[model samples]
Target: MKTFKVVVTDWEFENLQYEEAVLQDKRIELVKAQCRTEEEMIKVCRDADALINQYAPISKKVIDALENCKVITRYGVGVNTIDLEAAAYKGICVANVPDYCMDEVADHALALLLSWTRKVTLANAYIKEDKWDFKVTRPIYRLRGRTLGLVGFGKIPQSLAEKVKPLGLEVIAYDPYCPKETADEFGVLLVSLEALCEQADIISVHTPLTEGTKGMISKAQFDVMKEEALIINTSRGPVIDEEALIEALQNKKIAGAALDVVEEEPIRSDHPFLEMENVILTPHAAWYSEEAEKEMRSKAAMGVADVLLHQQYPKYLVNKEVKETTRLNESLDQERYALLTK
Candidate 1:
C-alpha cells in the first residue's frame, strides 16, 4: 500500500489524467470518487491524507470525520462550498486554484457585456424569426462614453477594465480594499457601493459569495439604478438577490441583466429569467476553456502534493489562518471566511 493517500472527492472532467500525472510519486496513491453528499464524503475522505475537491460539500460533519486529511485543494477559486471554519478547527489547509481562469472569466464577462449593449442576441433572434427589421431592437444606445461600474476590483475585474477601456468605456469600481494607486493606474474611480450602483450605465459583479457580499445588490441598489442600466455577474450567484433581480426585470427597474451564475445552480425550468427578453443567461460557464480546464486540474492536484508530499502550504490558500494557531474566531469576526483569496 502507498504510504500517503490522496482522494479526489469529485470532479467534472472526463478523466483524472492531469491529477494522476501531477501526483505521480510512487508513495502517493491517488483515488477518485463521485461523492455527492456529506455521508459519501465522510466515507472515502476519512482515510485520505489530502483531497482534490470540486463542488463536493466538505462541511463541518465531513471535516469532523476526516481522520488524516492535511489539505483540501479545490478545482476552482471559490471555497464557499467548504466550511473553512470547520476545516481550520481540524488543521486542514484548504487551497484553491485562484489564478488559473482569470483570462477566461474576464473574457466571458466582456462577451456578456458586449452582447447585451450591442443587442446581438436580440437582433439575431429577430432576424431568425423572419421579422427582418431593426425596429425590434430600437433605442440601443452608443457604448462610447458610458460608465461601467465593477463591484469588486479584483484580478478578473481589473482585466475586464483593461479590455473595456480601449472600447471607450469608463471603469469605476467599488472595492473597499482596492489600493488607490491601482485604481489611479487603471483610471478607475473607487466609489462606494451605493454610488457605483447609482452612477454606472453598466454594472458588473465580480465579488465572491460571503456574508457581506451575498445579496449585496438587492432592492435598494436596484431602486437607485437608472432604468436603462444593465447588470452583469460572472461571480457567485447569491452575490445578487435572485428574487429581487426577477422583480427588477419584471418591473423594468433596470434595463437588463446578463448572468453567468445564479442563486441556484441549474436554475429551475420555470425560472422567471427564461421569460424575460432583456436578460442574457449562461450556465455558470465564465471559468471555462479547454486550456483552463487542464490548468485548473494540474494546479489543484499539485496543491495536494505540496501538503501531503512536500509538507508545504498550497500557493493559493483560501484559509491561510490554518497555518497559525487558532485564536477562536478572532480573524473571522469581520471577514467571516468570505473574501476569496486575492
Candidate 2:
C-alpha cells in the first residue's frame, strides 16, 4: 500500500479525531503542528505529502520549502491566508471547505442583527446597573416592514435572507456578480450598492475580501445611510473601512453597528468600538458551530486524502489551474501506473 504523511498546521480546535477517522483507511499518517510563522511551518512541513492549514500563513517561502508536499487544504472558505499564487507556481494544489459554515455564519449575522435591533445586551447592561427604566433605551423598532440590504448575495447572505424572511423583512441585495433573476427567484430586490446604502434600514455585509471589495463601505456609503439604520458584518473585517465606521458611529450617521469580525482581530483595549453602547462586537467567530467545525476539519483532510490516495481533485479546489499541472497530480499519475503494472 502506498502511504502518505499529512501535516495539520496551527489548529485551535480541541480535537483531531474527526480528521483522523476520515483518513484512517487511506494509509495516511497524520501529524499536527501549531506553526505560527513561515520558518516554523517550513521546518515541520518540509517532508510532508500534504498539509491541512487553519489560520497559518502558507507563504511562497513555505511552499518553496516543501520537499514533496502536494496539496495544502484550508480549513475554511477564505484562502487569503494561503498563498494561492505561490502554491500554483510550485505546482501544489490548494483546496478549501467552502460550504461548511454557511448556516453558522448566517445564523451569527442574524443573531448580531437581532442583538443590536432589540437592544438585548443594552437592556441587560442597564438591568445590571440597577436601572429599571425602558425609556433609557428608546426607539426600538419593530422587525416587520423594514428593508434589509445585503452587500453580497453569496451563500451566507442568501441563507440569511431566507432565514429572516419570516420576520416580514423586505430583503434587497447588491451583488454585481449575482444575476437579477436569481434575486427575483428568492423574492429579493437587486439594487446598486449606492441604492442599498441610501435605502436600507438594516445593512448586512457578506462580501469576501478582495482588492475590489476592500474598503467598499467607507465614509461615502455611510453618509448615505439613514440616521437610525443598523449595519451588520459577518464577512471579512477589511471589507468595511474601520476608520470610516468609527467616524460614522461617533457622528451618529448610523444608529448602530454589529460585527462578528473587524479590520483588526483581538481588537485593542483602546479601540473605540469597545466604548460605544450602540456597537456590538464579537470575536471573529461567525463561522462556527460544533458540527461545522468538525465538517471543516474532516473535509480539509479528506481533500488531501482524495488527492493522495484516490487520485481525484478536491471539489472545492481554489487553484483550478493546478488540476492537471500540479506536481501532486503528476505524482498520482505515477502511483496509478505503478499499481497497474503490479
Candidate 3:
C-alpha cells in the first residue's frame, strides 16, 4: 500500500477539524500551511501528493514546483485563483466544492438588497446619532412590484429568485448558458442582457469572473439602468468595474450598490468605496454559514480522499480534460482507470 501526503495550501476558517475528520486515514497524512503567495505555496507544496487551497494563488510557478502532486482542490466554486492551464498541462486534476454555499449566497444577496432598499444601515446610523426623523432616510420604496434582474441564473441566482418570490418581485434573468426550458421551469423571464439592463428596477449580479465576464457590467450597462435602481453583487468583484461603479455612485446614476465581493480584495484603506454612505460593503462573506463552511471543508478534503482511497473521481472536477492523462488515474487498474476517465 502507498501512503500519501495532502497539504492544505491555505485556509482562513477557525479550524480544519472537519477536513481532518473526513480525510483521516492510516494511509493518508494531512499537513496545513498558511501559504498566501505563490512563493510560499511553491515552497511548501513540493512534497504534497494533493493540495487543498483557499485564497492562495497556485500559479504556473507553483505547479512546476510540485514534485508529485496528483490533484489540487479549491474550497469554493471559482478556480480563478488556480492556474488551471498549468495544472492541466502537468496532468494534475483540479476540483472544487461548487454547491456547498448555494443557499447562503442567495440568502446574503437578498439580505443586501433588502438592506439597501429599506435603508437599514442609514437608519441605524441616524438613530445612533440621536436623529428621530424618518425623512433622514427618504424615498424608500415598497419591494413588491419591483423588477429583479439577475445577471447570471446559476444555482445561487435561481435560489435567490425563489426566495424573493414571496416578496412579489418580478424576476428576469440573463444567462446565455441557461436554457429557455430551465428559465421556464424557474418561472423567470429570460431576456437579453441589454433588455435586462434597461428594464430591471434592481440588478443582482451573480456571474463568475471569466475573460468574457470580467467587465460585463461597466459604464454602458450602468448607463442604461434606472436612475434609482439598486445593484447588488455577491459574485466576483471584477464582474462590475469598480471604477465605473464608483463613478456611477458619485454621479447618482444609480441609487446604490451593495457589494459582498470587490474587484481587489482586502480593498486598500484609501479606496473611495469606504467613504460612500450609499454603498454597503461586506467582507466577501456571502458564502458563509457554519453549516456551509463545514460542508465545504469536508467535501473539499473528501474530493482528494475519493481519488486516493476509493479510486473514484471527484464530484466536481474542474479540469476534466486531464482525467485520462493524470498520473494518479493512470496508476489504477484498467477497471478503475475507466471509471476515473468517465
Most lDDT-accurate candidate:
3
How high is the CA lDDT of each candidate model? 0.87, 0.87, 0.88
List the candidate 2 regions with Cα displacement exceeding 4 Å.
Answer: 327-342
Candidate 3 on 134-206: residue-level lDDT in tens?
Answer: 8978889998998999999999999999999999999999999999999999899999999999999999999
TM-score rank, highest first?
A: 3, 1, 2
| Tens digit per residue, CA lDDT, model 2, 1-342 | 877889988888777887787778757988989999999998899999999998888988888899998888998888888888888887788999888899999999999988889899899899999999988789899999999999999888999999999999999999999988889888999999999999999999999888899999999999999999999999889999999999999999999999999888878899999999999989998898877877787778778877887777765778988865753333333353223212
TM-score (C-alpha, index-matched) for candidate 2: 0.92
- In candidate 2 the C-alpha lDDT for residue 261 amounts to 90
Per-residue error at 311 for model 3, in Å? 2.0
Clashing pairs in 2: none
State each candidate's clash count: 0, 0, 0
Score candidate 2 by lDDT: 0.87
The list of candidate 1 runs beyond 4 A from truth reads 325-342
Measured with C-alpha atoms, the lDDT of residue 298 in candidate 1 is 79
